[model samples]
Target: MSTRPLRVVVVGGGIGGLCLAQGLHAAGIDVAVFERDTAPDARLQGYRLNIEPVGSRALHDCLPAHLWHILVATAGDPGPGMGVFTERIRLLMREDAPPAGRDPSEQTHAVSRVTLRRLLLAGLDDVVHFGEEFTGYRQNADGTVTALFADGTSATGDLLVGADGANSRVRRQLLPHARRSPVPGVGIGGKLRLGDGAAWLPEELVSTKNMFLPKHDFLFTAVFRRRETNAATVERVGDQLRAAGLDPDLLVQDAKDDDYVMWAYVAHRRALPADLPADLPDVPAGGRGRRLRELVAARLTDWHPGLRELIARTPADTIERFDFATAERVKPWPTTNVTVLGDAIHSMPPVGGLGGNAALYDADALRRALIAVGRGEHDLLPAVAAYERAMLNNGFAAVRAATMYLRLATLPSRTVRTVARTFFRLCGVLPPLRRAIFSD
Candidate 1:
C-alpha cells in the first residue's frame, strides 16, 4: 500500500467535483475541492437539474445517509416523464410511461442545483475551499502534482482531477489541443411565477415537463414546486455558513413560495436576421432577465400565440441566455498524475439532456479507479487509462447523438422540417413506431 496519504486536489466545485470529494471522503481519502466562486451564494445556481438514475446513484453512493435524505427531501416532485409537443400545444409523444421492461429505479428526479449543492456541502466543512480560482498545475519531480490558484497560493497533491466545467483551465494545461466549438444555437431561458391567480399557462402544459418542438426551434418547460424551506433547513444551512466563516444573514431573505414555471427557448444561430441591431439596449451582466425576454419575443415572432405569451408575461429579470457549446473529441493522454471528468472531458448540447448524467457516471467511475489505486490493487496509470477509455467511448457517442438531435430540431430547410413533423406525428399515434423511434 502507498505510505503517503492519497491527497486528491479537485478543481471546480461543481456537482462532479463536489460529489467526487464526498465519495473520496467516505472512503477515508483526503480530498480538497477548489472552486472559483467566492462563496456559496456568489453566483446564480442556474435552473433545475433533471437527475436520472445514473446521477441519483452517484449521489446516493457518495453522500452519507442523512445527506441523501436531505437531498430527496429538498428535491422537486418527480411528476410524470417528459412530454413532447408541437408549438400549437398538440401532443406528439408522451414518455411519462416507462418502457414495458424498464426498471423503476431508472426514473429521473428533478432537483434545484442550489439546494443540491448546499446539501452536498453539508459535513464537508473543511474539505471544500471556495473562492480559489484554479490557474494551472505543475508536476513535481517527487511524483506529486501541484495545483496553482489565481490567489498566488498552491497545494501539492497525489493527483489532480479537473471538473471545471466546459471551459476548464486545467484541461487547457493538460490538453492544449482539445477544442470546444460553439454549437450553432442560441438558448434563452426564463422563469415565471405561477402562484395564486397566476393561471395564465394551461394546467396540462405546466402539470408535467413538456418539450415543444416547432419548426427550426425547440422549447422546453417544466413546472416544479419548490421544496418548502422549513425553519430547520434554514437553521442547518445557517450553521453551515457560520462554520465556513460566512455571514449567516447571507440567506436572510424570506423564502418565497415554491411555485414557478421554468422554460427554455432554443433556436438555430441563424434564425435571427444578421441585420438585427447590434447596439440594441444593453442590460448589465447577470441582469439580462428582461432583455432575454425581449430577445426571445423578437426571435420567435412566428411561434404560437400561447408560446409567445409565455415569454411576454415572464418577468424580465427572470430570463437569461445560456452559453451553449460542444466539446471536440479529445485524444487520450498519458494518465500520469493528472486527469479530468465531466464537462472538462466531454460536453454536449442540452438537446439530449445527457451531459449531467454522464458527468455523474464519470465521477463514480473515477472514484472507483482512484480507490483501487489507493488500495494498491492496481497501478495509477493503468487504472486511470481504463477509466478514460470507457468514458471517452461513451461520452463522445452521447455528444454525437446530442449533435444529431440539435440538428434535427434546427433544420434549416422547410422540406426537412415538414418531413420530420410528419414522422413525429405518426410516432405520436403509433406505439410501435414511438418505441422504435425512441428505443435505446
Candidate 2:
C-alpha cells in the first residue's frame, strides 16, 4: 500500500466505475476497482445504449486515445436505408421521419458491456480484484475508510464509491431508509443471429445503434447488436437462453455470446392506465423478460399489423423480462465513508439511456470534489453534500424524463404520439430545445 498516494476503492466495475477509475488514474490519483464478478468475461449483458455527449465527452476525456478507436470498432454499422418510424416503418406520416442522428465519426463508440469494460481496463496495472462482493464499510475518524467484502477480504482506502447496480449492498448498508421504486413496467429482450429471410430487419435496427418499436399492443421493441466473439462466453449466455420461457431451440446456432448479435424489447403492463393498480410496490421484483412478452401479448398488440408481424417473428425464448426500477433519492448514502455512484445512486429507467451517462458524470464531479477536499482547500462533508445536491436534482429530473418517454412509447395515444414524433424531429433542428433536452 502506497501511503504517499491516496487509496480509493470503487465497488462496481460497470460503466461509471470503470470511467471513474480511469479518470482518477489519469489524473495521477491511485485507485482500485473491486468488482463482484470474478472476471470481465463473466455475466454482463445488455443492449447497446445511445451514448450522449455527456458520457461520450467524459469517456474520451478520461480514457486514453486508443480506447476511442476500440469504441468505434464495436459500434453498430447502420446501413443506408435506416429510417425512423412511428406506427410502423410504412404506416407513418408523409414527411419522412429522419433517423436518430448518430455520429459514427465521433469519439463515443457504441459498444457491448464487455468491450467497454475491457477498453477501460486497458493500462490499468491490474488493481481490479474480482469476486470481491461488497459486504459493508466503516469510516474512521482519521479520514480513512475500511471496506469488507463477501469473500472475507477487507481493504482500506481514503474514499469509497458504490458503483454497484440497483441492488447495491453499499447503498443498502448506508442509506437503509432510502425508498426503492418499483419499475413502472416490465421489460424483456434477447439476441438471436437472424435466420434466413430475417434480414429484412435492417442491420441498422440491430447494430451499434438502438431501435425502438411500437407494435399494435402498447409493446415497445428496442434492438442492439454486437459482433461475435468466443465460446465460453457463448456457453454462459447459452445457459441464460436455455433458462428463458420462450423457445431457445429456435435460435439457429449457439454462437459466442460476445459475437452473437441480439435484440431486446421491453413492455410495461403497469404503464397501462387500466393495469396500474392503486398502490405501487416499494421494491421492484420482476427481473425476468418472459413476463414482459406475456404482458405485451395480453394488453398491447391487437391494433397494429406491423407490431404483430414483429412479434410473430420473435422466438418465445428471446424475451427476457426485467422491471425498470428507480431508487427514490434520500439522505446520507453511507453510514461511514462508503458512497454510491451511477445506477447505485439513481437507477433510472433506460428510456433516456441517461443512467450510465449520469453516473459517469457523477464520477467526474465526485472525483473533483474528493480532490478538492484532499488538498485541504475544502471540507469533505460539505463537498459531498454539494455533490449530492447536484446528483439528486439531476437524478430526479432524469428519472421523471425517462419514465415519461417509456410511458409514451409503450402506450402513446394518437395525439400524444404524434406530438412525440414531432418533438423528436424538432429536437434535431431546434437549437435551444435541443440544448435543453440533450444538455447535462
Candidate 3:
C-alpha cells in the first residue's frame, strides 16, 4: 500500500456520508465532505430513527465513544413490546418467531434524526463545504476523478462518492445513460400536539410508538414528549399548520404550550391516486396537509378513534410531502481510492428499518475493505469491486423485501391484508421463526 494518505471527496453529508467520513477520518485518511445545503441548521432534521442491534452495533464499531454517548442521551428506548400492529393483534412475519420472544426491552432505540445528524456532524474535524451543490464530474485517464459543484467550485480526489441522496447528481453524471429512478411513492409526515393528559387509548399504546396497518393504508405514529430544545422548534410548527389550512392560532390554543405531541408519517404508493398535487419530489409540505388527513381518514377509519382524533387535531400548515424512489443498484465502487455508502448507494423502503442499518454497515465494511487494501491483500479497484458486490447483493435483497412489506401493508383485499397481518403477528409470537424472517 502507498504510504501516502488518500484524499477522498464525499458528496452528501447525511447518515452515510457523515458516518463514512467519520470512520475514514478515524483511520487517519484524508477526507472532506461537500454538502449542497447552505448550512447544517438551515432546516430542521425530521423525526426519529430506530436503529436495531445490527445497525447500532455497526455504528458503535465505527463512531467514537463520545459521539455514541451523545446519541444514547438523545435516544429513546422503544421496548420490543413496541411492534407492528393491525388494530389490536400484533402482526407477525418471519420463521424464527418463538412464543414469548417478543419483549419490548430487547428492541432498539427511537432517536431523533436531528440528534443523529448532530452526533455525526460533531465528529468531523474536516471542513464540510456547504452550499456546494454537485453538478457533474469527469474521470482522468490516471484514474483520478474531478467533481464540479454548481457554485463554480471544484475538487479532484483519488475517488468520488455519490452520497448526495436520492436525486444524486453524481450518479446521474457518472451513468448518463442509466434511467433515473422514477418517483415510486409519496411520503407525508407531521407532529401533532395534544392535551397533556389526553384521552386517546390504552397506556400501552400511548406509552410506546404504534403502527396502524389498515386494509386501505398504513400509518406510523410516534408520541413525542415535549423536550426543551424541541419546544422552541415546535413554536413555528403552528404557522405551518395554518398554511396547511388548519387554524394555526386555534391549534396552538388547543394544546398546552408544554404538552407533548404526536408525529405521524403517512405514505401512499405513487401508483395510487396523486393524493396531493403539490408535495415535492420526495418529501411532504404543509400545503398537502389536508390531503394527507383525508388519506389517513379513509385508510384507518376502522382501526381506532385515537388515530382519527390525532388526525383531526393536525393543522393544515404542518403537513409535508415527498416522493420516495431510489436507484436499483450502483456499480464501479472504488476499492483502493473511493467507495459509496448510505442512500447514496442503495435506497430502500423504510418499512423494515434497513436504511440506517445498511448505511452503518457500509461504513463498517468499507473501512474494513480499506484496511485490507492497506495490508496489500487486495488491490484498490478489486477491493472496491468486492464492496460493490456485497453492498448491491444486500441492497437488492432489502429493496425487494421492503417493497413486498409495503405492498402487504397497503394491500387492497381485506383477506390478503388480514393474512399478511396474521403472518407477521405469528412471527412476532414465535421468536426463532420471526428471527428467521425479520432478523437481519
TM-scores of all candidate predictions against the true structure: 0.87, 0.72, 0.79
For 109-173, candidate 3 gives per-residue lDDT tens digits of 66666556655776464557788888878777877888888878899887777787656676566
lDDT of each: 0.76, 0.60, 0.62
Name the Cα RMSD for model 3. 7.8
Candidate 1, residue 169: lDDT = 94
Q: Give the residue spans of candidate 2 off by over 4 A.
A: 1-4, 77-84, 90-108, 192-196, 202-266, 270-307, 331-336, 371-382, 409-440
lDDT of model 2 at residue 213? 39
Residue-level lDDT of model 2, residues 1-440, one tens digit each, is 12345678889888888888888877777789998888766744556555655677767767765555445544443222223455444322222222467554333434566556656766664767788888898888988898888878888887788889888888787777866677556555555444565566644344333344344223333344433333333443444433332122223122433333444445556454353312235523232233444555555444346444455455555555555777776654433456777788678777646787788778877777766665666665677777777777777777777777667756636676667667656754665775564443
- Sort order, lDDT high to low: 1, 3, 2
- The model with the greater TM-score, 1 or 3, is 1
Instruction: List candidate 1 stretches off by more than 4 Å.
Output: 1-3, 99-105, 226-257, 273-291, 298-304, 432-440
Go through the candidates in order and give the clash count of each.
2, 19, 44
Cα displacement (angstroms), candidate 2, residue 253, comes to 16
Total clashing pairs in model 2: 19
Worst window of 10 by summed lDDT in candidate 2: 245-254
